[model samples]
Target: QQQVKQSPQSLIVQKGGISIINCAYENTAFDYFPWYQQFPGKGPALLIAIRPDVSEKKEGRFTISFNKSAKQFSLHIMDSQPGDSATYFCAATGNQGGKLIFGQGTELSVKP
Candidate 1:
């Protein structure tokens, strides 16, 4: 109930395409859901997030869709690009200051 598992350890897409990644958790106690994008040698930054109360959230070209009942969520990158190629991680925080749990990293490569 405290782990987030991500798929497709790596992905490749052409520029201007859509990149989709999925993650699921077993814990229902998780309240704060966040997706973080990280570039090489940089710390993960919060990209977009949603709570159990919300079904979906979007920010610019990034969108996070959450499924409370199924204990799952996903990240969709619109207009995939070479510059967008990087590692993305799905994370969760149960309460304030609760250590964020991260899914196995995903390497996304958008070919130019």
Candidate 2:
């Protein structure tokens, strides 16, 4: 029950449109949920994260909505831009755990 599932293998959005990506997990032990964004030929960087105690978190144009009872989470990008084009991944880890259970990445493209 440590698996994280993500959907919308690819997404295309207009520059001023909204981009939404979803993720779900099976392990209730997971405490930390972090989203990462990766560009071509580069390492993934942390975008935003949330703990189980928090229902939602937002930073700049990125927002994460978490549902503890449903064991699901989603990432919403407001005012999607061409600069936001990248591969995003959602990951989860338990308390004091170093290994992150990552979801299948969702490739997002924002057209100018």
Candidate 3:
């Protein structure tokens, strides 16, 4: 079965702190990993993405650290803010018709 397991169903971070979310995958067919951020009453948006070729990718305060050998990846939010309070999801998809598998999801709350 193809699936991604995510940790910390809910997280609480202080403003200006770092928020970390972890995920692991079971499908080797997956070649692409993407993180999505969803605000209340809004659909999820692509926050960042990574491939097996890279160990890490950073865009502004959002960074994705990947471990291909271990089949794991993580998202780090630097300088966490209340505005960042949203549900985060880790997903994976491969060349097999581009079927995407999503993790359980993590609801992150940034407290001021």
Provide the global lDDT of candidate 3 against the true structure: 0.95
Cα lDDT of model 2 by residue, 15-42, tens digit: 9999999999998888899999999999
The sequence of per-residue lDDT tens digits that candidate 3 reaches over residues 1-112 is 5879999899999999999999999788899999999999999999999999999999999999999889999999999999999999999998778777999999999999
lDDT of 1 by residue, 1-108 (tens): 678999879999999999999999998888988888899999998888889998888898998999998899999999998999999999888895778999997999
Q: Candidate 1 regions off by >4 Å?
A: none
lDDT against the true structure, per candidate, is: 0.90, 0.95, 0.95
Every model's TM-score: 0.95, 0.97, 0.97
Error of 1 at 27 (Å): 0.7
Off by over 4 Å in 2: none
Residue 72 accuracy (lDDT) in model 2: 94
- In terms of TM-score, which candidate is stronger, 1 or 2? 2
Ranking by lDDT: 3, 2, 1
RMSD of each: 1.0, 0.8, 0.7
